[model samples]
Target: MTVQTIPAPAAPLRVTPASPLFLREDEIRRGIELLYFGYTAMIRGADAILEAQGLGRAHHRALYFIARQPGLSVGELIGLLGITKQSLGRVLTELQARALVEQQVGTADRRQRLLRLTKAGAALEARLFGELERSMARAYGEAGQQAVTGFWAVLMGLVPPDDRPRVEALQA
Candidate 1:
């Protein structure tokens, strides 16, 4: 049997402008499709790295947030990740066992556990972030400042108002 290969597109696909009535079904579907495909493409590189290290997206999410806010409490991480305590426990356990993360007792609350990335974890996180940054930077460059701002606005709109503060805190 002969193997067949699909040829890559010769150029990037042209972006279609949203309809004046962006709330139309076609426009809404296009937005959903773009979000899905764009996110998949953006995370593809980081996914490979995670797989090579025997980790998954959950582990990456934990590492990423911990790296962003060292000493983040386990409770806070659970809130941020929107994961069950048991799920977070497993991810944290594996991370600590692999020497990619560490947890310290909270200063004020002895029962609270705070999370931080180990040096190796930081290095790995940086590499993964580098992959994401490159992809986002390229897309942002192509989209220009106004378009990027609009994109951010659209994304922010998708977040529930109650949860916006939690997401905004990441920018701090």
Candidate 2:
């Protein structure tokens, strides 16, 4: 007997907001500009320090997440980074070559490779985090408690729904 297969329907189009809640185009544009500048400034704050070590944003992010969740597996790091395995591999290779990160076989699963920051890595991460904290502290202080909370909410909301669980797990 021959079997027939049905194709899946295409996803529905996204709806644009029509109410007062929608932001003006100019306002939206300004918000985008602000985000760009804010991110640039935030990275610049740590760039000098990272530059001294010949590292970049990818290295910093890997260190940050590994420091945050010690013993995180290589697979988990790749997922959390949202980067290709090749990209992550380069970063991990650099970090490992610099003696900043250590990887060991997982106790529960021998096939899994667990990662941790070495003492040097922790120190570097702390310094990078300190630079970030200086700027973040000032921003949060100026923004006030409510704004700070709102900022976190907005940032969290920007994360993909599918990745929220992984983010929440890290937060916990």
Candidate 3:
């Protein structure tokens, strides 16, 4: 039999005084602006890459999420992407035609069509998404410690508090 090891948890520490930070309004505004700037640059890069392949962001989003949860139903993908049915249909058609994604009927629910990535699709997503991830990481690193952590906090706040549990569960 194979053995497994798990690390023990550390004991809780007592409260301590932290460094004081004077965050001015202008500085906070700049922080928000940097968030916008960073997002725009990242999107521009991803758009160019997708355009080169004659695909769009919608396609990228669809492929990216579906890859994470293979066999996702059309309805489920619709919910995740939060796009109009017509818009999604267009992208799904293109993906299906290219054999990047395949749709199969749900076993119990005949009306539902489940989507999954083919080997080629997963490979393509990895190549494209790898670039996006690296670029984003570099950009955030350049933004320094405060902006990086602050930006994460801001983005996390964008999601509703009620939905946080659901989001955390999914990531878990």
Candidate 4:
């Protein structure tokens, strides 16, 4: 005798009108407005901390991520950030000119350069951590654990599967 088994039904996803995704046209418009406001406020907060140090978000991203994983290749950074080659080149030039980053010739590949944060760059990263962590902590405190987890889940959903490991490695 042969037996056949049926797969179980998938669980339903929970979403609300306030969620930018499932909302109707009018609701989506309102949600977009809120998102714009929130993003603007967050950038403003970040800028306030960054401006004093003469560093902007782009430099901050490079410094922080490079410090997180020293010796990460330029190719790896470009892949993780998903920016155009020209845009990344400009940022790299700025960082290198400032002596915040150093490029070492790849051991195996002569043409390839591996990037690392210089001592100054690592110090800047360590300094920025306090302010960044405080801001994020305050946001999490206001949002609560469930909201924070949900927000992370929504963000992770936006990323492709193959890119998830790179993001997770940074988090680690």
Question: For model 1, how does the per-residue alpha-carbon lDDT over 1-172 read when each residue is reduced to its tens digit?
Answer: 1212322244433588777898999999989999999999999989999999999999999999999999999999999999999999999999999999998999999999989999999999998998887788777666665787889999999999999999999999
List the candidate numbers ranked by lDDT, top first.
1, 2, 3, 4
lDDT score at residue 155, model 4, on the 0-100 scale: 70
- Candidate 4 error regions (>4 Å): 1-22, 25-31
Model 3 per-residue lDDT tens digits across residues 94-141 = 999999999899999999999999999998888777767767666544
Instruction: Kindly provide the TM-score of model 1 when superposed on the true structure, using C-alpha atoms.
Output: 0.90
Whole-structure CA lDDT of model 2: 0.83
In model 2, what lDDT does residue 124 have? Answer: 98
Error of 1 at 140 (Å): 0.6
The most accurate candidate by TM-score is 1
- TM-scores of all predicted structures: 0.90, 0.84, 0.74, 0.71
lDDT minimum window of 10 residues, candidate 2: 1-10
Better of 2 and 4 by lDDT: 2
What's the true lDDT of residue 112 in model 2?
Answer: 91
Clashes of 1: 0
RMSD of each: 7.6, 15.1, 7.7, 11.3
Point out where model 3 deviates above 4 Å. 1-28, 140-150
CA lDDT of every candidate? 0.89, 0.83, 0.76, 0.73
Question: lDDT winner among the candidates?
Answer: 1
Question: What C-alpha lDDT does candidate 4 achieve relative to the native structure?
Answer: 0.73
